[model samples]
Target chain A: MTSESDRSRRDVLILGAATALVGAGLAGPAAAELKTVVYNNSGGASADAARAAWGGLMRDRASSNLLVTAPASVARLKAMIQARNVEWDVAELVSQEHKQAIRESMLQKLDLSVIDLSHTPDDCKDEYSVVYALYSTAMAYSSKIAAAKRPGSWAEFWDVAKFPGRRALRNHPVDNLEFALLADGVPKDKIYPIDFDRAFASLDRIKKHIAVWWRDGSQPAQMLIDGEVDFTSGWHGRFFALAQKGETGFGVQWNQAMLKRSWVGVPQGAKNPREAMQLISFMIDPTASAKYAEGIGYICCDARANNHLPENVRPWVMSNPAIAELTVSANEQWWLDNGELAQRKWNDWIVT
Target chain B: MVRRWFWIPGLGFLVLFFLLPVGAFLLQSVLDPGPTFMHFERLFEGRAFWVSLGNTFRISITVTLICAVIGFLIALRIATLQRPYANALLVLIVMTVWISLLVRNYAWMVLLGREGIISTSLVALGIFERKTSLLFNEAAVVLGMVHVLIPYMIIPTYAAVQAIDPALLRACDSLGARPAQVFSRVLLPLSLPGLATGCLLVFTLSLGFYVTPAILGGRGQTTLTMLMEIEVNEQLNWGFAAAHAAVLIAITAVLFFAYRSKFGMDRLWGQEL
Candidate 1:
């Protein structure tokens, strides 16, 4: 035990000496910069876009000290928060996650005072989260079945007689349940207190038609490419990515689509909470948000950002007003209250 | 004495990497933040658990049976062949084993999908008026598992069949026993040890298979692994996931012991197995 204590003391002495050496080795006093890490699940192109926007903004700011880092998974972010080693100053969370995180007291409350909100959408700014990305879970159909018309709404999507072929749905219960409920003739406004029995009954009606229940965003898209099924529910951004490569083999309709927002939150026990708040403030800036949307094919509700976008890409990034009006916005607070019951019902319904 | 020092590092690695994580996860099965069995009770009550457990066992048994028949034949061929042919056959079996399971499953998917080569050809031949897809179904899952597991069956059967003395077969021939009699009486009993080992290996693997069933199987065809994944990733219920996994592990262990005694594979296979 004495030897162990002595060894630790020697190690501490060495660490202190190393720190002193590093302090002495500096060429000059460095500028005071707040280094903040951002946890993001969108790793490939979206992360690059986030980094690019922040890199320029950080370079120009004299007193504005900020650094952003993006980690990949919510499970990892949850671990960091639980351990109180929250390296993420700001994190991108899905709507359900944002709601759950807030309920769990995992996030620090957002102070809107630090942010410029003159051009921000009222829906985007919130007490606990700021909308980072907006995408749609919409309908898509294969063009291979030449006789079948494109499904424009949930009702039409469910009209197997008119659009006859095998169908696909995501493995998750969230959007699919909503769509099924909608097809069962539940009004969009009343979707909140979901009539559980009716919703599941509606799901059962079309269960046999569904040939593939995909796990990831990419799976539905891959299924379309693979011709695994004739029609499916899909994300618009993924379809847009495919459409950009000339003529897409499948088509998507924005009618009755569900719009989901990804939000950024700072953990309550972040390693650098102040730095994280600064990064969050920067993220809401119209210019930065616009650039991110442009690169990632997602919508950010900075009105200024939408106005500044390249004309060709703007329509794709922000849902056209006509298209946007047709879709229902997910009520995350409702989900927070009802998720457990809904998840249980979903599991039992699927098994049955 | 030298091995004792080596064992310290080896045992340390096992305890740190394997035992610690497993122990922690197993503890999570019973002990939640509030110290309750809520998660396990929830899992047991859910129909998904029972359905997927049944499906997992059903697939494992089916795959094991198919593997035994096909692998036994292949191993018999290899054992009876000349040296060069036997070497080539062994290399082929190893090659199949070496290929990635994901790659093999994807290949099967391509063959079975709507616009896949098979479907296209069938359509062209007027075998069907429209393209028929078989991508996500129980059949595809079983076919993929069988293809992947054949090598497991083959290796053991080959080793077991090879162990039977040539002189035994010669003695049977001298006694005017037919080839069929020799195969049933002499060869089949001698190779039973290997067949038993291979079936168990394939069966255990199919029970735990996640990726194959997830990619290939459709609704009502999902397995225990998929259910466990849904619990962990979608529901974020690690406790329930752990309990389900523990149940699967326990079941597999029980089966292993039962099979070991019934077939005497415990003696025939190596100690590590």
Candidate 2:
């Protein structure tokens, strides 16, 4: 009887060990799979587009698996990083914010070997971050006003007497300061380490003329569409989306459009780093990239993607001499250094 | 004993959802990378932060005073009506309460915007020269808030006014007291608890309002809630955002206690305010 009891105890111990081994086996692949969490600035529409772009790559059975999720806001994602519980595997961040995140050491160094760069433009491919998408902040004016030779550049956009209608600008300091400096005759390539005093002085000149200071990409577009304002600062995609909806008598001037890049970053301490890189690689496919650009009304960073684009929209999507002059690359480092101060000063100035 | 077990699930739910989240959020305010007062110090240093703080208090006080006075009168009028009329009026007040706050705020926005009904009417009536944009001003913010908050004020006032004994009014009149005197001496005093309660409710709610201020008062107007929102949403300054939220919650608690003590509100059962 004592031998039988001893045998039962042995059996229990063996069963426990077997369960532990099976549990570890189930968890191992998920652990090995590189987990990438991406923070998308756009709402549901963009989230859907990103998922579609990544769906095929993730569907194929591979050792490295992809995981995609978007935080409700950039702030929540930043909070996670700040807390040192960096759950985000990857994030789609704005140009100005990308600089801020890098300065804070919340991001991981990009490994080119993991990312497929075959379709990436020479200018866009970089050691730190690859420019994921290109969009413009251009002057959008009413069609009625467009007939009146509406403002062609930032200087003209700020000239109340010349443009002669209610104008609106973004509420953000980053783009607004650039627009102000440009109006003050600062060259597009030299709009960095922004002359804050000069920019604010210039901004003050047209402050009263601005009936609205838009807070979102959609606002400036909506303002022009509804005739709430005659001229406003707008993103190309927003206006493009508006144009697609109907014959909205709104047209854009690309002459002095501020070109900005939206970048994707892999956060440090990601659950699945390899999968994140693979997903990032899959997202840059020229054909898939072009399809996304057309669907979303923004240009992809992949120059080869331009070939797949429609003939009519090709010029708008690709980098050319004309497009280059119209675009201004924001100095991420300058903004990183000055963003907090600029924001504080902007709030004080607006309130006063 | 059987009924006691039924409460276990509800107790668990509260512990899991409301209590746990709030406790965690409160913990985040002070106990950051390390326990520090840095967030609060930063908040106090900025003039914008101080100004917004003052604005929040000032607006909430004014709104609460206006709501209480107006809500009390309406409640009194409804309470004095004939049974059928009072019953119908009660239904209307309840319906207003039932309507979503977002829808109400939107309705008020249409009434107040530059191209909205009010501006259009004023222009047609030759009250103003050009269409004035009321879309981003202090007046617009207050107007939006009062509309959304009036129902909260009215319901509580109605209950208080309804509960006032009719015999006391008759007694005052029999003793040669004027209507005004009777109101000042008895009716108003009796309703003080309710009035204080409603004011407290409106004041606390208006303190943290976001959408009304954002849509109606767009720029050059912000409250603590808006500041917290910007920090979390745009700036991604969660430490600052958490501090702001913590301060707002603390202020709300103080206001709650102040209201309770002032009117002996703690004596009443099932009176949230």
Candidate 3:
């Protein structure tokens, strides 16, 4: 027992020394003791884009620092909220989730006094969150096959006979319900508080032709590249990236795109709330947001950033004026309130 | 000099790694957000869980049946071959087992898709007027599941076949017993245990499948795991998700109990009946 306890103590000592060495390597006289804030967002390509944008710029300011992290999932966030042990200073939440956060009071109201809002739009900055990226779920089709009979809108997407082939759609009701409503001749502005009966009826028409119900943001793009299905609806960035690199032959239909904004929110009792707020303020800087948007194919609301982007990349991003005009903003609050009911209906509809 | 207390470490590992998490889930399903039956009640009251559960049973049974037939044949072929040839073929079969399930499923998606090699080739050969997709169908899901499970079926059956006495076959031939008689009376009885093992393994594994069906399954082809995921992730209905999980556990347990009652639990672990 004595030997085993001694070994554990030695192990702890070694671990402590290694950590101290790593910290010594990072620390310098010039490196001010900036309170480190873990900026939690969806990891992968978007995280890279975010790092390029706000990460370096904030670090340059030498104010409170930030470290980018992956997926602060709702479950984890809720647990932290309940326990009063907020791990992340800033969390990137989607539209409905952002609204859900506010509704649950999991997040503290942002101090707009610290964050500059002159360039950021009214809709982009709420009390709880500041919009980081506008991810558009748009109609993406096989560029090779969709040309002659391309689906210009959700209506055309459902027209299997005109452009007869298989399709992959997101399994959820979030955007698909809106697309169904739109295809059924519901106006873009009137999509929210979704007409459930009508929407499901519309979805039923094209149900037989759907070849895949894509679960991931990346799946639809690969499906298009592999020619798994002739048509699918997915995140705009994937289709944009495919087009940019000429990696896969694919086309995007921006018309009636369900554009939803992803936001960075401060947890209610974060250790570094001030730093988190300042980091969010710096993130909304027009030039940096533009760079972030260009690097990733998401759209930022700052109009000033649009002119700085290269011409070829403009058409792919939501920053493109033409593409912007084509998109319809989904109601975040409505989704927050009605998401559960919609899912229940969706579950029944999907099985049938 | 090894004591019975030596087993404590392994038991502790199982308790820590397996039992605790599953026990937490079992507890959480009932106790979380206050104890209520609404979540489990939703299963019978709603069409989603029933449909998903139905699909799970159908897909698992079908895959198990196909694996049983093909796996037994392959084992028989390998057993009848020369020792070196049998070893080479066994190596080939085992090599496929090393490949990731996702990679295998994705390969099937590529081969069976609309503009895939088979579909395009068939169209080129004037077999069809337009390009067609073979993916996102029940057949594709079954085929993918069967492909993944066949190796599991083969190894056990081969072991059983390999253990068969060759002198018995010579005696049967000398006694003027027909080839069919020898196969039915001797080989069939010997191999039944292995075939049963393969069927149970394949069916149970196929029941829990989420990835292959998620990637390949279409609108109506959704399974219980997929439904459970949506409940957890999308709805954030932990209680409901737990209920679905409990259902899965219950089904697996029921199947296992039935098997154990018939064959005895010892056979399931290693011993052949």
Candidate 4:
């Protein structure tokens, strides 16, 4: 009986080992045969939209599988590049981070031939990256407030006597510094290389009147709709999305909006650089860009995408001539140089 | 020898997954880009770090103390209950822990917002002349954290209280001790080790909290974890983040050792050392 049991156990062990070896061998070659381009972006609605817009195109054009990952982190990018284990083939970067990555040599130079930028603005193109979309940090208010009483400008928004309602600003330093400078009557062109002393002084004047300093991207609009605050600084795209859905409880004021670019780039040492470049090219195709813009309520940099958009959506797009004329482009180069010190100062200042 | 071999899998998992990664990350504090104390020096020099550290300790202590008082009373009640009833109540308490932390925080958000149920009811009841948002403040953060952590406090205390011999209490009563006197003298002392363990667990967990404070709190509520997040995510300063983590780990270790020395390690497992 013992010998019979032993013989069966030996046969089972040998069969199991053979199966494992065969599985490993198949996985090695199969993985090599299939090309996958990993695209990491700020997840949520944008990621979903990108997958819908370009995932199929990437598969058809590049013959590569598209993998998506969440909430882009520059620190992770740095760590991966430093370790020589880059995981993302294509990654999205905010304007300041785009500049910072270039400075640190963490991004690969774009093959402009593969990624056409003929319709893209000159300002949107760079040696290592291209601005794919534009979003604005603008003031939004509850629709319950009358138009006459609305604080139209940053200066007006700061005037507690005129507006006479609860207010919330973003807890971060980036847009708040610019807003403070504008509120202090600094011209839009003169806002860069920020005058910190003047800006903080302006912030001090209105700090006590502010009801809340919001952190999350969703907080400002939610606060507005819920009537937690009558006015808040929020991203324009959030309010635009709500408006598109016919939810008019919140109204966005595009006047003096801080226009920020969202960039796409290939990271250094990407496994499939050519496929990553192809994916970028696919993302900026007019039809795909329009669909992505309509889905997320953010305007793509390519002006031709405007032709594909519905007439009603054009006014909401930041690139429309009328809206573009009124907005200010944030100086990302200045932020790239001084972001760390600015953040430290902002953290100290907010608590105090 | 056969039993000793059984430890290999568990010990190997801890060493490979926990110890190696944590050790390497912490080592980056001093060794990254070369051996230097600049990260620590920078951390000490920053005023925000100190402010956040103070907020972290203050919030943790408050949560721990509140949990201890409330947890002990609940535990005492459960200890005296019939077996099935006690088990049912214990299951209910543990069930709350199974709910997503994000869901709980969002529920609190709805309850505490300006036009939320709490604010509207309070205004209608004439408790306040105007509706006020109770969210995005220190109180909301404490409340959210206490809700999540109370189970940790109750479970350990219940075990300790259940381990108490009923004869000892009866003996004390026969010796002419009052109800309050029995509690203060006998029950409290016997349950001290369990209470200590619960406090340590809750306090350490509270110190590392990120979501509760971030979701429910305003500008003034930044904690050590939030500061570390900003460093790692926004500033891309890994070495500085490593330094912050190292400090947090050191403080936790010290508190643990202090607890271990006072209570003896076996009390952690509901036994006398």
Candidate 5:
């Protein structure tokens, strides 16, 4: 309890009033309907989107409201579940995280009847979650970089002699495996059921030239902007954001753009699970999704969401379905099954 | 009757805020999902674990030594200043703590980045033909940690320095002791507790550092905190994370007792250092 008696009693009163308000009638009063709902995310761009596009839009319309938080971790989720005290009403999860949460029964099952998934991509939807936004693990290079030519494929990315500059990539093996396979001459269509031997071999080729094995989505972009690395494979939005600011000499090669997806799942035993599920459905609305994508520079998984955006604006936004079709969707299940092994291998590979 | 029971609130604070939660965490490290010691086993099983542990101690000690040497001079300067000047120096030192850790790390990035201010300024002055990679190096990591943790060291040492009797300094001066002799023989020995306290504070605080190393340091700079983060955040291995945390706790506990034997426990008490 707080040292201040006023605050301690007020917290108790708020709890009592919230319960009484819920018990009175589910949809009785606008002010009382959602006394509290804690929405958790991985923070940064995603949190900003929820605050502006979703929370800002629904502030006047809905009785329920969201209080945003930063960087949800499964460890925290498990600890809360074990203590029988859940804080997050709605938690943003990756595809594999959604799977793990489902296995642990750490998330509530969704009711599709309430959620109109007509606009949401079928492959994107999950048992306990709704898809949020899409990004890419694509090639980034400085046009001003000294080389015979720029790298357009993973094979060329491995060729340090031609590139002749330091490079940056994520520290994880999720997309790196696929990129390595592609670099080893595996066709884009036939990249799955990955040949591990060849992939690691492909990695060993360029591993020495990699100046930085960045961990965050934005680090590689920042490195490229700072000229710490001549090339990198990072989130397209990172370089795109820089480009829109009139920063020159940067180019993106989206040929092998691998789609990265995010989802929103209700944590099991949340105080407002029903309200959280409803909010998920509400956010899947095309206008909200597009406004979210526009504000955050991520692609909305719902194709129709971009229809709300002007055609000229879509070019700058990377919201085009044509480019989406060309880009390959990451096999989340493959990673989910082999993730620990791959991650261990990645850790050993980098450290040594 | 209740006047002597003032310690109840303090005891309540420790039990409610510290003991119960830490007890749960340690218990879970051994017995989450099912009763097991596999989490503890995991701590010793990997090369990554050993590497992270080694790096954490290495970086923290390096930061501690740097902080101790520089911070003592700062404290000594502040302690010997005129009243207004001493207050002004302290305010300047304390002002840095007001800025959040993340902003400070980002500021370091902007200054030390390849295209950052220092590099650009140097390049403009014809120092180099091309930009050099300055950030994401060991030097940057140490620089960032020292900048953030020095204040922790300075505050306690400053307190210790201020508490020394001015009459002792005057007595040494009256005995015809030179300034250097006065400091080395009298002030230095007297200020040992503060120096010890400051070093301990900076050393312990640096062990849990995350954002600075994560932002300013790259692959080679990865510490135990980052490794635990990988286990907890990326791998979702809380059992292993808890075990790793237990290792840190056990190490800190041993150090706590070690420091207690050398300098009384009263100094480390009440500060949460």
Candidate 6:
């Protein structure tokens, strides 16, 4: 019985190795013909928008295949880089993830000559990454509430007695801490290196008032549309998408909006770094950026893209000077340093 | 010789696909970067870890108890019914399991939301003064979990109930025992093993629940799995996440062994040990 089991195990091992070899053999020949640049980004409508914007452009212009992957993850990036098996040529990093990636040396420095960022805003450009799209965690309200009773700012949002309604906030520390600080009367510029004590104190006041602590990006806008919530802190693009669909029951308040940048960077040890840079350059081209923005409500950081945008799209986008002025950029560096602590505290606070 | 060969493939699959990766990942809790208990140390230091751990056990126990009670009743009813009726009822219970868990959770969200059917109907019928959201609470999370996990409970309990000898039940009934007494003495004891198996299944599944709680539950429903996700995805602290996973694995292993010792392995396969 022992001999039989040992022979069976050896046979199983041989079968596995043969299968793996066959699989690799099939993939190797196809991969050698055309250079593939895997661009990993947050999937769903955004991925679709990206494909619509540059799928043809990457193939036609760069003579490379654009293989888009889903739900961009910094953890996956770290693993890939650590294992010395980098799969993604270009990866989209959400908020402070780029900073964390850069800190860990998980990303390659951008070759500015290949990826032209001169047209991009100075604040949006980094040595290792560039902000491709601009979005905000902004306040949105249901049209069911009277216009007069609508909360315009964080302070007003906290005043539950005045603007009484079911409210939802994102179930995270990133934007909520800033919102708490702002509601506690911290000036927009002064709202960095956050005082956790003051912020939590402020949050403690409005804690019971918040009906839902929404986890997903789509939840806040959907909640408003469903009348599940009257006021919510949600991504601006979600509300914009709904408005574009002619759903007029919700209105976004841009006042004190937490302006966030979506970054794209080449992972360190990527196979096709040059092609990846070229793809990034193509993505930020004025026409391409404008088309992408139209597909999804998230505007690219390129100021030149504003010229190609239609008049209707201008007021809604972050690139508009009027809207841009009302927004505050979150301190990504601070978040990079203290994210774990903030997460722990936030988790503790919520449960207690 | 053929049976031995069959064992190799299954054993190899488990070793390669499950054990090797999981063992390496769990090892990271101590051995990551260097050998240290820092991750575990930090885990214990945080209130979030303790609270979420408590929440996980509390929710799992609640879900297990609820599933056991409901499942036993349903199984008992089905066992007494005609074969055709019983099969149909069992199929209906099993059908819910086929639906995606996310779809089911979202359905509950629609049903329990502020302007949802139940809320609106309640208000219209004057049962409620106004539409109030029945969602974003521990109750909603439990309801969602119980909905998803009920099938796991019912299937096992039904098997055990159907296996019970009708003659034995008749033997008790003919001894001038009351209907309640017969059930209490014979059927209940006979069903305990199945109910225990169901409870184990439901409880363990509940411990690892992530999506339902995140969607249906509010601030209070943060479970260990949810916390682990934040650690892995948001915090990018694999060592810490591994520590969380290790703790969960340890508890589950302990529970599994206890179950195995109490009810021998054959009981798990519907054998009356």
lDDT for A107 in candidate 3 is 91
Residues A195-292, model 3: lDDT tens digits? 89999999999887887888888888888887777789998877766666667677778899988888888998788887888788766777777777
User: Cα lDDT of all candidates, in order?
Assistant: 0.74, 0.70, 0.79, 0.85, 0.75, 0.85
The clash count for each model shown is: 1, 8, 0, 0, 0, 0
After aligning candidate 1 to the native by TM-score, how far in Å is the CA of A97 from where it should be?
0.4
Q: DockQ winner among the candidates? A: 6
Q: DockQ score of candidate 2?
A: 0.10
**Which pairs of residues collide in model 1?**
A38-A69
Ranking by DockQ: 6, 5, 4, 3, 1, 2
Report the TM-score of candidate 6, chain B only. 0.96
Model 5 chain A worst lDDT run, 10 consecutive residues: A1-10
Clashing pairs in model 5? Answer: none
Q: How good is the docking of model 6, as DockQ?
A: 0.25
The numbered model that scores best in lDDT is 6
Estimate, for each residue in A1-352, the C-alpha lDDT of model 2 and write its tens digit: 0111122222222322332243232332244434334434465345655666665566573343344455434565666765777666667777767666676676777777888776677666555556677877888898867576698888988787777888888777878999999999998778777888999999999888887777656677666665667888877877765565574678878877878777777777766676667666766767767666665556567667777776655555535446766677767667766777887787767655
lDDT of 6 by residue, A1-352 (tens): 0111112222222322332242232334245456888899887667777888888898888888888887889999988987899999999999899989988888888988888888887878889988888988899999999999999999999999999999999889999999999999999999889999999999999999889988888898899989999999998877777787888889999999999989999999999999999988987788998888876667778788889987777788888899989998888888988988898889889888
DockQ for all candidate structures vs. native: 0.13, 0.10, 0.18, 0.22, 0.23, 0.25
What is the per-residue lDDT of model 2 for residues B72-122, given as tens digits with 9 covering 90 to 100? 998789778765676577566555655666677767656665667788789
Badly placed stretches (over 4 Å) of model 1 are A1-39, A43-72, A80-90, A108-128, A144-148, A266-282, B1-9, B81-92, B95-99, B263-273
RMSD of each: 10.5, 12.5, 8.5, 8.0, 8.1, 6.6
Between 1 and 4, whose DockQ is larger?
4
> Which pairs clash in the backbone of model 2?
A34-A272, A34-A273, A34-A275, A35-A272, A37-A89, A37-A90, A38-A90, A39-A91
What is candidate 5's fraction of native contacts?
0.28
Instruction: Note the chain A TM-score of all models in turn.
Output: 0.81, 0.80, 0.86, 0.87, 0.84, 0.88
Report model 5's chain A TM-score.
Answer: 0.84
What's model 5's overall lDDT? 0.75
